[model samples]
Target: MKKSRYIILLPLFISLTIPVVFALTSKGQMLENFKRQEKEMIFESQTIFLDEGDRNILKTYNKLNVYSSIGDKIQSKREYLEVQNEKINSRVNSLESSIIQFDKDIEELVIEVNKINEQVVSTKDEIDTNKKTIDILQSRIEESTVILLEYIVYLYKKGDYVTTDNDIDNIKSILLSGEKIDELVNDLYFKSIIQLTGQQLIEKHRDFVSRLYVKKLELQESENQLKTLRKQGILERNILDDKRSSKQRILEITKGQEELYQKYISEQLELERDIKVKELKEQIKLNNTKKKLLEKYNCEFVDIQVQQTEFSALDEQCANINKIIFAESRLSGIPLENNPLDWPVNPSLGISSYFNDTGYQRLFGTDHDAIDIMIPMRTEIRAPMDGYVVFIQPVVNTGYAYFAVKHSDGLVSLYGHVNQIDVKLYDFVKKGDVIGLTGGEYGTNGAGLLSTGPHLHFVVYDEEEYNDPLNYLNLSYLSYKSLPSKYQFKYKSDFKSRKGFEYADTSKKQSTSGSTFVIEGENELERQKYLLGTYAVGDFRNWDIWVEESIAGGIDPTFMMCVGLAETSLGKYLKSAYNIGNVGNNDRGDTKDFPNARSAIAAMTSTFNNKYLGKYNTINQLSRYGNKTGAIYASSDFNWHNNITKCMSHVKGEYIPDDYNYRISIK
Candidate 1:
């Protein structure tokens, strides 16, 4: 069980100690030093108390009813912090239990090592006694050997023993004569006694020598056993030291983690407090602002016309209209009869919220007064009609920039959530004139209050009351879907004809005989394939035929593909009838449809080759003329050539120029 616990902690030990080892010393001595440090340091249980003030702050803010998203975010953060704190506490508890177990293990190992030490000392004492006995036995054996040698010498001198045959015969003849029988008997008895004594002494000496050798062997074994016990004791002590070190290291790390978690929890609580306070203050400000806006709307405005002297003092600026290209939609759906106002932005960009949209009441705390036109940040906000700039908020980063245009019809158009404005107050702007860039991305300048995402809030007011801007401008079928069902209108296939742009006559057939098209780079075909695959242009998955045909027709294949992108988003918005480029779209909204993507591509390339490529071979050259595919092909669209050029640069892996001006000469 103890070993299993150590095994479980092995990974933690390595993880905690290895980094310290690397930070302080070389790899060779890192582990050794860590072990030493851990063993030497004393460890105590760490108790980290939660800060009451931090807890109270969180509890106080959490109790208050905050309906804003910020409040919800703070609550979520608090919950996450709580979870983290609980996890930390759990881990600390586990580490403390592990440390306690290690302490117990260390104590056990210490006792075992001491017992081994006692056994080792006892074994050493036995070995010493055995050595002393072996030495005494050796001395006794030497003395016995000397006594036995003296006895042998005395027997030889007394002639009590004989080995020669002549001496034995003489002794026999003397016994027969019976002259010294008694003396012989006496000598024999004394010699036998002396021989017995010597034999006993030799046997005793052999026994002592054998016992001495046995003692010496036993002493060697005892010394070896003592050494083994000492080694075991040392091993136990090492284990005890390792356990102590492990416990100390765990305690130290747990203490540090506890402190860090406490600090983090405190900081999170403080942050929550600050956020709640800020939200409360902003709520008050927003209520006041809303009240003031309501009062302002209720009152009548006196027109303050700017004199020539005052107008000349401010900078006169105009908005850039070419930055945006309106997507294809039914223009006839919009009501334009006797309407001075036009669309402030492309209707196809869609609307997020409408006037008095109840969906917005929860966020704004009131009925939405204006329509929210959904568009990306920095999109150009255009003048809907010929109007004079009546009010302009020029602050760029205060989130309060907006401008109002007073139209001749006594209607006012207010554009809000604007970051950049070009025109000064009292400046006259015609319809479709660019005014400024729209904003509303969160935390960005001009996002103002209650911005969920990027969009333009467009408001209109008559002298009497606030009016829905949708009532004044033409609405497309696409944007019509974004409004409440009451404002939506049924569509008719036979819609009115659209307005047209100036164009040169195309009554005569154009020839492609003079056209000479060139591909841009050596690797352009492969590059175009990669770009098409990257954009997942499905129509061009089998695009080799389209590219070959386009190249054979003396037009850049990339430009042809770009034309496809410009018209249909590379076939995403292609009409179901399979006209990839909307090839023959005109003012009446009629389009030529092919049977397949390849046929469409071929027809588009051929049309470009015959009509436009004969004069303008390159995209730059084609775009150089007024926005009508060099004033011949698709002569109504102002953004056609620009879009194609942009796509050409993009697909060819060239820099897409930000400048939308297509009039500049290409180098």
Candidate 2:
């Protein structure tokens, strides 16, 4: 009974233990998976951050925002700087204008000062002249006074009034005899005569003296008037001196003003220089700041990458936990699957050409690579399968309108000659989704080089190579026989050949020469070696060779004859379809007839090689066919025949040419 009870308890214990073990194991696995997934997420984030696309996006965002901010700041600063500069300029202009005006004033003042100095000099000369005149007048006045006194004393000593009078008259005559003073003083001296008798002279000496005194007084008054005149002359001279002094003072003031103005101009110039220097310094600082901000943005992007990685890790951990918990939740659930095959167009009309063999070449070669279904103009075209829109190219030569859809399993279908493309690239499309409509006569037939008639060319490629959709679909050639009569396609009988020659000429004219070659040196060996090297390994589609021999011969290297061998295998082949020269078409010409083969090869080779490479002299020297001096023959002195042999041997030989070492030795 106890054993049975332990057994029943064991069941409960096992159940509890199993769940614990499972939970622990799941938790550990979830943690481990989370760590692994987190590391992967971190690595992916790092890769994305470093990838060009993501880096460009980040860089653009940073550049745009940083540049915008910097630009805004720069604009604001520029505006402010402009205002400040204007202010400084205004100050400078004002200062300069004031200096100019001051200079003008100084010039005027200088002129005035110069005039004052001249006046001062003139005044000093006039004062000196007046002083000399005053000195002469004083000496004359003193001499006249002394002579009159002597004459009065002589009359008293002579004891004869008449003699005294005579003596006085002699004195007056002497005093009046000098220049212009003689007329005025002669008249004044003669106006009152002095006489003294012997008796009367002694008795009435007092009375005579008195009379003489009165006469003397009158003479003294005239002398005083002369003195006053001299005083007035001195006063006038002083006034002129004062005027000259005032003028000198004004000149000094004007000179001082000029100096002050110059000082102000110097100060203004220095201030402007200082302001400019400050502005340059600020600009440098702003640029450094912008650089620092860019560095910070880079750091921020790195931090964001780290954070995103952390978040992804956490999300993965939580997802694992949920998966573990919900493993059996959908065990009995049903899944829905839908497979839809889309028609290429709307079902408004029947398919004129079914996807099958029609016993003839349609468009893509001897066997049609695609199915041609005739439709009306402007008919809507749709997607044939649920896929992603891969390409929508509207190239003129290849297709009038074309769109491609990429499905799962590397399957791709093309709809050509479309009128329009409504869907965008990488768009997820379902079957029967409308892409575009058909239009133009060109769409009906391929048109120009590619043509048949108005029909939709539907092609499906598997893994990039063209494949017959009918074969892949495992359908019969006439599987649509059971369908309605409208869906059947009518086969053409005895159709005329298209005018393909005109189209070929047009295409040739339009085609561009796609390759160029250059010879390395002026030596014949170098030229031959260059041709051999290029022709042996170069792409056959577009090829040309240049040599220095053309330059020495005064011909363009582009027109060199031997260069065509690199393309047409030395006159062996001519491409008739595009009127191009190639190595593959050699078998078409008669091998027995050397002239016909050579002529055909030479004509095609000359046309293409000359057209593209003739511009340079390097290629012209290598021409063995078109030299004017007839030096290109096999027996020419330039060893033209030997060079061709060397080139052919070098290119065709499995190892290096036998002459290569000998050529090196000669060099």
Question: Number of the top candidate by TM-score?
Answer: 1
lDDT of 2 by residue, 1-667 (tens): 4543221111101111221111213323432343243233322332232334323332232333333444444455545544554355345435545545555655565565566556556655555554555455455545654554455456445655434455556545655564222222222233333443322322232232223322333344445445555565566556555655655544553446445445555655555555555555655554454345445334211122235564344443332222211221111111112212345754334344445433333223244456666667667787766665555554343334566766544466777666666775445566678877765355342222244555566777666566655433312122233332222221101011122122111122111122222334333344445544544323322222222222222222332334345444443353442222332344457222222332333333333234443332222233342243532212233334334333333332322221221110000
Find the 10 residues in a row with the least total lDDT in model 1: 321-330
State how far residue 476 of model 1 sits from its true place (Å): 1.9
Residue 530 local lDDT, model 2:
54
Task: Please provide, for model 1 over 180-259, each residue's C-alpha lDDT reduced to its tens digit, 9 standing for 90 to 100.
Answer: 22222223333344456655765465466546644654676687788888788878888888888888877776868667
TM accuracy, model 1: 0.26
Q: Which residue pairs clash in candidate 1? A: 399-446
Q: What stretches of model 2 exceed 4 Å from their correct place?
A: 1-340, 346-365, 395-399, 443-449, 471-479, 482-667
Score every model by TM-score.
0.26, 0.22
**How does candidate 1 score on lDDT?**
0.55
